[model samples]
Target: MKKFFTSLQTKLVISFLLLILVITGGTFLITNTQSKKALLDSTRDDMLQTVALVSTQFTAADLQTLSGFKAGDDGSPAYLSMIRRLRDMRSLSPNMVNFYIMSIAGNNISFVVDDAVSGPALVGDVYTDPDPRLFDAVAAPSVSDNFYTDAWGTFISAYAPLKDANGNTAFVVGGDMDASQVITRQNFIGTTIYYIMAGAILFAGFMIAIFSVTIIKDIKKLDKTADEISKGNTKVSVDVHRSDEIGDLADSFGRMVASLKIMMDMDEQPGDK
Candidate 1:
């Protein structure tokens, strides 16, 4: 077993195989990481664009009027108008999971216009416990990057503040996209990368097998020639002709065989002339 491993053919094959594995593994890791980042960035950009489009549909006055009304007071003009807008926005894109308007006051949040028809909050119902990230979104000059989870599930949210005539934020418009979609996309990319890497490894293995066979064939020929030379046959010749290290070894062996043949012929002569 030790001899087998020490053979030139085995060493050559193993060296190439290890090299291929290292290269393929490193490439796979780099490609997988970059792909995940690109996909996530693309998803976030799409979310931002969707939020921008939705926010454009409402004016500051519309948001101000809606903020003055309570959640359950759907009969009010502002309330009804905002609900209609939310429904329209929801229908505009299938990816838009939730759309609503919110009012933020010093870490406290109150729902002004929630799309939930059956069990929506009342206008005065305030949520004192708010994620700090949510405050960052409310304070952001434009759309903010934030993620949150609630009864609906995990979501990547984009917030756009609605400003009154005096340039103060009257209310905030928010759009949510299910975080599961991003996760699913990432998983798909990972699977694809795995498949590609598997194919590449198999191809490298096949090529290496062919290369090892050629090298081993030449080495066996040299070995057989040497064995015949050991049995008193000095006329054996190694036919391998190349410029590589193996070729150089074959050339040296051929020269030694020739020298031995000359010495034998001289010894067979009658005597030293």
Candidate 2:
């Protein structure tokens, strides 16, 4: 056991294994972090694009009329038509959770148009959330950074502005996507990366084990040759053909044996002695 541990083959295998571990660990960490960031950023950009597309479906007049919409008045032709248009826009993307139009009056914001099924805020209900960023959506060039949560679920939201004929902001069109989907996708990617790293480590270990066996076999052959030469069997020759350090050692060993044989021959000659 002690000889096995001190063997060159064992040392080489251990060194390679440690190197693979370090490199694999570092690569997995970097790749996992970057992949998560990239995935979330892609999702955010898609949500923003959805907001922009949904905003275009409604004209300034449509937004202006919907701002005064009252709850329980779903029978109104204009309200029904607006809901149909919003649903159509929502259908374009499977990731979209909800699409709606909101009006900001002073510090108060109210829902203008929304699908009937997921209605939390009535048409005229005042939003009392402490977040002041909701008001910024009135003229927001792109999506709002602030997320929203309610009884329905947590969401990442985006908002775009609707402008009247006079270029005055009329309403803000917004869309929501489930935040859980992003989290789930990130988890899935991280797990896949971990598995790949683990597989690489295992394969490296297997190859190292195989290589160690071959090297140890060559070393044993050299040891046996040395044993034979020590016992005065100087005719024994090591047949190592590799072009490595082991091969060099074998060549040197062969030369020493040849020299020992010449010395023994010279001593046996009566005149030379």
| lDDT assessment of candidate 1 | 0.75
User: What is each predicted model's overall lDDT from 0 to 1?
Assistant: 0.75, 0.77
Clashing pairs in 1: 70-123, 71-123
Over 114-199, each residue of candidate 1 has an lDDT whose tens digit, in order, gives 77555665576775544345565555524324456675567777777776777677777777677888778888998899899999
Deviation from native of the Cα of residue 200 in model 2, angstroms: 3.1
RMSD of 2: 3.5
lDDT accuracy of residue 49 in candidate 1: 77
User: Candidate 2: misplaced stretches above 4 Å?
Assistant: 1-7, 71-77, 116-119, 126-136, 144-150, 227-236, 261-273
RMSD of 1: 3.4
Look at candidate 1 and tell me the lDDT of residue 96. 67
lDDT of 1 at 110: 85
Clashes of each: 2, 0
Model 2, 27-90: lDDT tens digits are 9999999999888788878887878777677776686677657777666888888888888878
